[model samples]
Target chain A: MASGRPIQLFRNMTAKIAAIPMILTALVIFVGGTAWTVVYSFTNSKLLPRANFVGLDQYERLWNTNRWIVSIENLLIYGICMLVLSFIIGFVLAALMDQKIRFENTFRTIILYPFALSFIVTGLIWQWLLNPDFGVQNVVRGLGWVSFEFDPLNNSSIVIYGVLIAGLWQGTGLVMVLMLAGLRGIDQEIWKAARVDGIPMWKTYLYIVVPMLRPVFITSIVIIASGIVRVYDLVVAQTAGGPGISSEVPAKYVYDYMFQGQNLGQGFAASTMMLLAVAIVIIPWAYLEFGSRNRG
Target chain B: MANPATISTAVAGADTLPLDGPQGPRPRPRLSRRNIFIYGTMLVVAVYYLLPLYVMIVTSLKGMPEIRLGNIFSPPMEITFEPWVKAWAEACTGLNCDGLSRGFWNSVKITVPSVFLSIAVASVNGYALSNWKFKGADIFFTILIFGAFIPYQVMLYPIVIILREIGLYGSLGGLVIVHVIFGMPIVTLLFRNYFASLPEELFKAARVDGAGFWQIYFQIMLPMSLPIFVVAMIIQVTGIWNDFLFGVVYTKPDTYPMTVQLNNIVNSVQGVKEYNVNMAATILTGLVPLVIYFVSGKLFVRGIAAGAVKG
Candidate 1:
C-alpha cells in the first residue's frame, strides 16, 4: 500500500469524498476545537480571544472567585448524590421489575416515560413541585403538618438538592432501563440454581448477579458522569443559580462568563476545568474497555 | 391459604384432571402476600414517576384563582383550556410576548433541516466506513466517537469562532450546522453498526456487477436500512428538539428553541408568577417528545439502548 503511486488517493476517492464531513468534524471540530479552548484558557482574552499570554492568571481568578468555589461544591454534592442514589434506585427498580409480576409493560412505560422529557421540562416541573408557597410544603401543611419546611429551591444551602431531586427524577428512569436490560441478559440457570440452593433473592442479586453486570454499571457511570458535568440547562431552568448563586455549577459558570459576563478568559478557564472533569471520568473507563481489549 | 374453598374444590376435583399433570401452567393466587408486596411497591413507584406529568396537566387546566386556593396535586374543579391558549399565544419570554409560537416555529425550522441533513451525512459516512474501508477511516471514526465523551463546552467556543469565521454565526443555518456536527458521532455510530451487520455478500455481488461505491450504496444500502434510518430519526428529532444549550448559545433571542424559550417564560423574574401558564408552557414544550415517545414506544427504547451501548 505504501509503494502505491500518487494516484493512490484517487483509488477509493468516492469513499473518501463521502467521508469528508466525518473527517472534518472528528479532526477539525472535536480535536481542533478542544485544543483551541485549552490554548485560549492561558490568555487574558476578555470579550474576544487574543494571543496575549497571561499564564495561570485566569486560573487564579477562577479559583479565588466565590461562585466558582460554590459551583464546585454544588457539583460535588449533586454528582455524588446523583451517582449513589440513581444507582440504588435504578438497580432496585430493575430487580423488582425482574420479578414475574403482572403489568410489567405498564410499570416500565410509566417509569421510563420521564426519560423522554427534556431536562429543562424536568427542572421546571420539579421547581413547581418544590415551590414552597403552593407545592409540597403547602400540600403537607394542608394535610395537618403545619410546621413542614420543604423548600429547598429558595433556601441557599440546600438549593442544589432541589436540583438533584429533579435530576434524579429525570435520569433514574434511563438507569433503570439499562439495568433491566442487564438483568434480562443474565442466564436464567443462575437464578434456578440459586433457588435450588435456597439462597435468598437479595443475596443472589448482590453476591452473584451484580458482579456480572459490570459492563452495564460502567456504561451507566460514564454516561451519568459526563451528564453531570454538562448539567447546565437543568440548573438554568430550575434555579438559574439563584438564591445568591448557591446552586451554581461549572457548566453554568462557563456559560455565564463567556456569553453572559463577556469575560472570555474566565469562561475559557472554567470550561477547561469542565473538560478536565470529563477527562477524569472518561480516561480510566476508556483504558479499561479499550486498552485491555488491545492487549488481549 | 387465602382461598380455602377454591383449594378444597381443586383437591376434590383432582380425580377429574389428567393423570399426567395438573395443568400446563400454575395459577398463583392474585391476593397472595408476595404478589401484594411486589404490586404495591411497583404501584407506589409508578405514581411517583407519573406525578410531575399529572401535576402539570391538572395545574394547566385550572385558573389561577383555583391554583391559589388549592394544592398543586389537586384535580381542577373546573377545567379550562385558557391557560394552554395563553401559554401558546400570550406568554412572554424576554421582549417576545408571542409566547412559544416563535420558539416552536424556530425549533421546527432548526430540527427539520438538522434531522434530515445529519442523517443524510451520517448514513453515507457509515456506509463508506463499513463497506469501502479506506486506509484511515477507522482512525477518524474512533476519534469521532471519543469526541462524543468530551464535554461540549470544550468545543463550544471554538465552533463559535468557526461559525463566525464562515459568515454563518448567530444564524439558523449555523445552528443547524452545529446540531449536525454534534449529532454526527452517535448517528454515525448507529449507522456504522447497522451497516456492518448487513450481509457482505450483497456488497460483494454489487461490486462484481460493476457497481461503484455510490451506486452500491444508493441501490443496495439505502433501501435496506429504513428501520435504522427511522431509529436515527427518532434519536435526532427528540435530541435536536430538546436541545436548549446549542439553541441558547448559537441563536439570538428571537430564534431560541422551545426548551430555551420555555425556560425563559417560566423563570423570567419580572412576571407576576402565573403558575398555570408556566405549567401549560412546560407541557407544551414537552408535548413533542412525549408524543414521539408514546407513538414509537419500542423503537424509542431501542434508540436509547443503542445510544447507551455506544459507549
Candidate 2:
C-alpha cells in the first residue's frame, strides 16, 4: 500500500510536469506576444521599439492614413476574390476528375504540381506572363490582333485582379485535393442512385454533391481565408504592391512600416487591426468548431 | 443494377429519344464522347495552370535578345546558360554580388537544425498530451492549436523584442529558436492527431511492461511516427526554406536565407530588370522543395491525408 501511494504520487507529478513546457511556450508566444503588440501599438516606437507610451495616437494616425485605408480595402477585395474563385474553379475541376476520366493520375499530378512550386517563384512566373511588353499581349498582337491590351499588371485599377489570377492558379490545386478527398469519402450508392433516378450529371453535382461536401467546403474556406490574411510574399514578388500601391494588403503594409518605413508604432497598430479583422471572422467559426467537436 | 437501357431511358424524357437509341439508325453517340469532353476540359485547364511555368523555363533558357523579342510560347531562337551562370555566380542582392550561393548555405544552416529541434519538441509534447491524461493538458493543447491560427507576422515584433532582451536576437541561435516556436503548433497538431488515432492498447502494454513515459515515447512512439516525421520534415523544410519576411526580419545580412536573396534579386526596382535572370534565380531558389516534393510525393500525400482524415 505504501509503494502504491508513491507510484500514484509520481504519476501525478509527471503529468503536471509534462504540461509545463507546453503551457509556458503557449503563454510566452501567444499571450505575451499579443499583449506586447497591443502595448507597442500605443507607443511612439519606430525602427527600434521605444517605450514612451502614446495612447491611441498611432491608431488614430493609422485610421487617417490613405495607404492603410487603401490596404484594408484591397485586402477585402483580394481575399473575397481569391476565396470564391479558387473554390469555384477547384470544385469544378474536382467534379470533372470524379467522372473517372482517363489519365487520372497524370491529370491529378498536373493539377497538384503547381502547389509544390513556391509562391515566390509562382509570383515571378505570373509577373513575366502578365508583362505587357513580352507576355500574352505581345503574342496576341503578333497574331495581327493589334487591338489586344493585357496590361492588368501595369494598370492601377486591375492589378489586384492580376494578383488574384496568380493566387487562384496556385491555390485551386489545394482546394481540388481537399474536395477530391471529400468526393472520395462519399458513398458510391449516392452516385448510383442518382444515375438510377435519371438525374442529369450537372443537377446531381449541383443539388447533391456540392451540398454533401459541406465540411470539405468549410475546411477549405477556413484554410484559404487564413492564407489570404497572411498573403505577403506573393504580392511582394509579383507586383511589389506596385503600379502605385494599388495592390497593397494589410500584411504587406504592416511589413513595410515595421521594416522599410521604420515606423514600428504604425506597424503594430496595423497588425492589431489585422488581428481584430481575423478575430471577427474566425472567432465565430472557431467557437462552432470547438462546440461541435466537444459535443461530438 | 437495373438494365443500362432502362436507366438511360428513365433519365431521358419519355418523348426524347435515347442518346444511344436506334431511330432510322441515327448517328451513333460514341462512348468516347463523354471521355473526350472530360479529358479535353482537364487538358485545357492543365495547360492554363502550366502555361506560366512553361514561360518561366523557356524564358530562363533564352538569350536576353530573344526574351526581349517577346514570344513567350515559341522556342528560344538561341539557348544560353549565361543567365543561369550569372544568377548563381554574380547576381547582386544589395551590396553583395556573390549570387545566391552564400544565402543557400545560410538556408541549409537554418533549416536542418530548425527541422530537427521542432520535430523533437513537438513529438514529446504530442506524446504527453495525447497519451497522458493530466489536468490542464487539454487546455495546453487547445492553446497550442489556437496559436496556429494567430498570424506569425503579428507575433514577429514581440518575438524580436523578447529575443533581443534575452541577448539572442539577430543570431543563428535566435532564428532557430523562433522557427521552433512557430513550428510547434503544426508539428504538435500533426503528431497529436496521429497518436490519438493509434490504439491505446499499445501504450497500456508498454506501461504494463514497466516502461516509463520517456522510454515508451523515445523507443516505441518515435519509431512508429516515421510517416508523420517525414511530413513534419517536409513542412518545416519547405516553410523555412521559402520564408522571406521572417528571415529578412530576424537574421542579420551575414545569415540571410536564400529566399531573402531571391527576393532581393527579383524585387530590384532600380535595376534594368533582367527577366531571364530573375526567372532562373527564382527557380533555383525553389529547387530544394521541388526536389523534396518529387522524391517524397507518395509519403507527402499519405501524411497530409492522414492528418486531414482525423480532422
**Best candidate (score: DockQ):** 1
In model 2, the Cα lDDT at residue B4 comes to 58
Q: What is candidate 1's DockQ?
A: 0.84
- Please, what is the whole-model Cα lDDT of each candidate in the order they appear? 0.92, 0.83
Q: Model 2, chain B: what is the TM-score?
A: 0.87
Query: Residue by residue across B134-233, what tens digits does model 1's lDDT show?
Result: 8999999999999998889888899999999999888999999999999999999999999999999999999999999889888999999999999999
Per-candidate RMSD, Å: 3.7, 4.6
Residue pairs in clash, model 2: A198-B11
Candidate 1 chain A: worst-modelled 10 consecutive residues by lDDT: A1-10
- Calculate DockQ per candidate and list them: 0.84, 0.57
Candidate 2 chain A has its poorest 10 consecutive residues by lDDT at A12-21
Best by lDDT: 1
* A1-296: candidate 2 lDDT, tens digit per residue: 85887676567566567656677779988888987998889999987888899999999999999988888888888999988889998888988888767688778777877777667777888888888999889999999999999888999998988988888888888888888889988998988899989999889889998899887887788788888898888888889988898989889988889978999999999999888877876787787877798899
